[model samples]
Target: MFSDILCVILFCTLHFIASSSELQPGMPNVCADQEMSMLGARQPCVQAFTRMVKVWKQGCNSHRWCMGYERRTAYYTVYRQVYNMDTHTVYKCCPGWRQDGKEMGCLHRVCSANTCFNGGQCAETGDKICQCPLGFKGTQCQYDVNECERDEGGCEGFCCNTIGSFYCKCPEGSRLGPDGRVCHDVNECEELNGGCQQTCVDTPGSHHCECNEGFRMHSDGRTCIAVNSCSVLNGGCEHKCVDTGNNNYKCECRKNYQLKRDGRHCEYTRVHCSCRPGFTLAADGKNCEGIEMEIVNSCEKINGGCSHHCEHTTNGPLCSCNHGYQLALDRKTYSDECVSGGACCRHFCRNYPGGYECSCRAGHRLNPDGCGCDDVDECLAETSGCEHDCVNTLGTYECFCELGFRLDQDQHSCIYLLFRKVPQLLQYTAALHSRYVSDEDDSDGGDREVEIQRGRRGELRLSSSIVCLDGSFGDDCSVSCEDCDHGVCSENRDQCECAAGWTGIICNKTCSQGTYGPACNSLCRCQNGGSCDPVTGKCVCPPGVQGLLCEDGCPRGHFGMHCRRKCNCPNNGHCHRLYGGCLCSPGLYGRLCHLCEYQ
Candidate 1:
């Protein structure tokens, strides 16, 4: 029985040991320390503490914890309760081990508690913070992303936000593009041409109506109407325009007019003119008149007989004299009676039945008016007539010979100037006489030869005579002088003698202050402090004077004599009778100042 009791005691002791080995309440399956002794199996405890520190460093909850022993104590207690086991005396866990609700293993380094939503991520930070994705907001990312709030999702037209996404929309006439953000215009005209009658133009959001060629749009802007070409200024016709249907027209000209090349204008076919005698038909053979015809034998007409010679005039005929003749007292008979005593002929005269004929010597001809004679240009007419040179005079021409020759009396021939050296002999004789006189005191032998030469020179010089022509006077017949003012020059002398009231050698000087005219014989008749023009003999009066002489004041209504004048103009007008002009006041005009301009 004692042996049986010993066996039972031993079995009871083994059962107690086995029960102690089993995990108890508040105790982990693996223990780092035994009896809470650091020296016994302290490695497992150190390892477990190190793992807890690591988990705390990572984060105890989705919300970050404060970094302090006091703040971490609560987290440490919770972590210890969640991960370690209680042995009725101490709490412990295995080395490098942790517990996270139904899972026991190594420490989890992340602080994620399913707090973030909609693709958001919870960050392992000191505080509970959610890193939301794009377009998301709020603490736990519970709100949908509002992409439209920021930038309208980069939409071109309109934006619409919905549950973490966005969409773009367009207007009525536009549609969204492939990019889902841009808008494109919808061309309604492209389909059935917008149901237009003629043409339709597509606009940005709508369309418009138009017309085709030669057609205009109606007021409704949809229907097309036929254009009326004739409605525009009668088709731009000069005469009558007739429409020929279908926007076409034709121009019709009036009487005596025809259409021009442009088919729209009209031009007169007949030209009219004033019919008059002596006018011929025009080149166009129309009603116009042309140049006048020439009249002939006008003296044969009635009341057109001329006493001497009949000459045709523009109006009719007239009497005239023949060449080299003059009309008599009857004004019809030509005769030479004027040349007998009237001094009509300049050179020669001849008598005729009805007129007097005047003739000029050779190298002269009658003037155009048949009053005087003029020298003929013989050199120009007959260039070969002279041997060397030709000189013309009043009634004759002279031919000049060369230096060794002379002109003959016939005036057209040249002769040698024989004995030309005779004048040179006189010069030699004087030189010889001077030398003889100078040497006389030294020797008198050369005196006799010099005296003989001097006597011969004097004889030859005396025999030769230098005769001056009729209008010329001088030792060599070379000097000439014109008659004095209004006075004739004497043929024998070259002196100038002025006429009455005239002076100066060349007869060019006029009379003194009180005389004027050809011979300056007229006396001045100026009055009222007036002066005379020396050449014109007209009076120059002072201010306030008029007439031939300045002897009167300005006329009534006339002012400064320089410009202002009197006026008898009507309708409050002014007139300048001196200039035959009239100036009417405002609203009135005309030569007589009787017309109203505005009216």
Candidate 2:
């Protein structure tokens, strides 16, 4: 019953939503419930997701894992016909961008975020181009230009510098000139009484407010209040108060060095500290003092730097090959063992990850030693679901029906096909069977089986021609293609699709000289003058490109190992894709292109 429900894509394959097809309607829903796919979802399993940087306990970079923090699961009421089964597809954050958690969108990249300062906007081209607003300059528009720095800002009064522009200010008794730079004298008493509560006094360039003898001027300088002693509000002190002249006082801490929060409270200055990546603190409570070296398991860091499997041991992560394959000396790669020695077995071999397993022909069983092929007597074992006689062969078995019946498509059960049987016809068919049947062509001349043809009147007739089963071909279908020893039989059933490094008529020969791939027909695709494995065509890129294919250039603003390092070049400088080096801009000589030539 659980099969009817589409898997939520529990922990992976969220990219399936991006690539689904219409599932054919009323096709009997032939897919098994297990086939519903956490591996392939019909739609977006996650409604929203976020990207995270520095994910803990994480160490792989492939298109197989969804690089996101999923916030919630999304359900669809309508069923979809399409499903994406490509195991390699997954949503991932582009270089220089990470998810907030593992949610829906790494939608934010370098330019997508607010990287610019002081009203600067980054270009969407992903080259880290920062477009600065007026009165600001620098790579990220971080520098505020001060307009008043030169020629006194061409103002008669004082000039005030602001973010984008500057303004002029006149003296207290003067009004700003129409030009906004000149100043004109004016009487302060004429306007708002100079902001005085009681009396106003006008000066040459400013004004003053006065209060009665019983009252004192407030901090605002425009209002007055009654004078009070330290008894009022405890002089707003949190520690010992020292009375000064005119009821004024200062607060002092006892054990601590300073006062906090408006000089009213006292506390010790707390130090919040932390250590770097590989170091821990000492037992003596020193600041990051203990320095110890630890060789972490490479597998834990990056799967032991192996392309296949990595096993952690007492010493370190040891790379190992998958079954049917052998590890190389470097321990990071593996080679197919079947082509080397596995093909010696009489039975065929099936391919799988890491290794291949030897499999016997349709009705044959492999001997204990694995090289010998023995026929399985389905008649003796009673395992064949045949409704009639079961005939055993050298490496397979065949099912036969009673005189009036015919073989079913299953090839095991008998179906009533003949409308009537004649005694003379039966005798003639019996004679023919006795003359031609002995085994899979072991009788006299490869004529072991007879062909059944349907006539225009819907009656079955025995023909002299012979047709082979699915895997068998040749004259009577009795001749199984024994040539494809450890490889797959080709579509035409004439040749074999040899493994990466193997070739030849029977796939018994290795790839010749510098050739690789199926039948040794393709060449390696290594770039930057790199080398490659002749058998697998696996490229070994030089110190430039970061892709396994040795493609030039890296993701935007990223370079170096795993393309994980970000470039800090300024003024549209190019960055090395594999080394994280910045190619400085013209006239800019320093590492980050910050130093000017004249300087």
lDDT of 2: 0.56
Local distance difference test scores for all models: 0.55, 0.56
RMSD in order of candidates: 53.3, 57.7
Candidate 1: regions farther than 4 A off = 1-114, 119-121, 124-128, 213-599
Residue-by-residue lDDT tens digits, candidate 1, 1-599: 99999999999999987666444445543454446322222222122133223223336467566343332222122212124434435434443234554333323333356757788777656444677777678867778877887777799888999887778988867889898988899896775345355567999977887875546754334445447655555655668978764334578999999986656567789747544334565766656554656666666774254545866665456666667656555444443454335646666664444555677877667877575665565654775378766543333445666454544434456666444123221111112122123332213443444344323222111112344444443233332363243566755556445565464443546677777665676788886446677667788754345688654544323433543433333322334425525645457667765688878
Model 2, span 1-599: residue lDDT tens: 46445454532455664433322222222221222333434553324444435433344465444444434434445444455553333334444444454345443445545678787888666545588888998767888889899976888888999978899998666879889998988766554455455568888777788876545765445444435434444544556766653334557787635775445457776555666435567665556764556656657777776657988764456777666567655556664445344344565754445555666787677767665565666765898777976654444556766565655545687766433222121111111123122233223322211111001111121234444344544322322345364478877774467777777555667666446777788876665444567577887654344567767656445577666554545422457775668765457777765688987
Q: Cα deviation of 78 in candidate 2 (Å)?
A: 99
Q: Number of clashing residue pairs in every model?
A: 15, 22
Residue 406 displacement in candidate 1 (angstroms): 99
> Residue 285: error of model 1 in Å?
65
Give, for candidate 2, the lowest lDDT window spanning 10 residues: 449-458
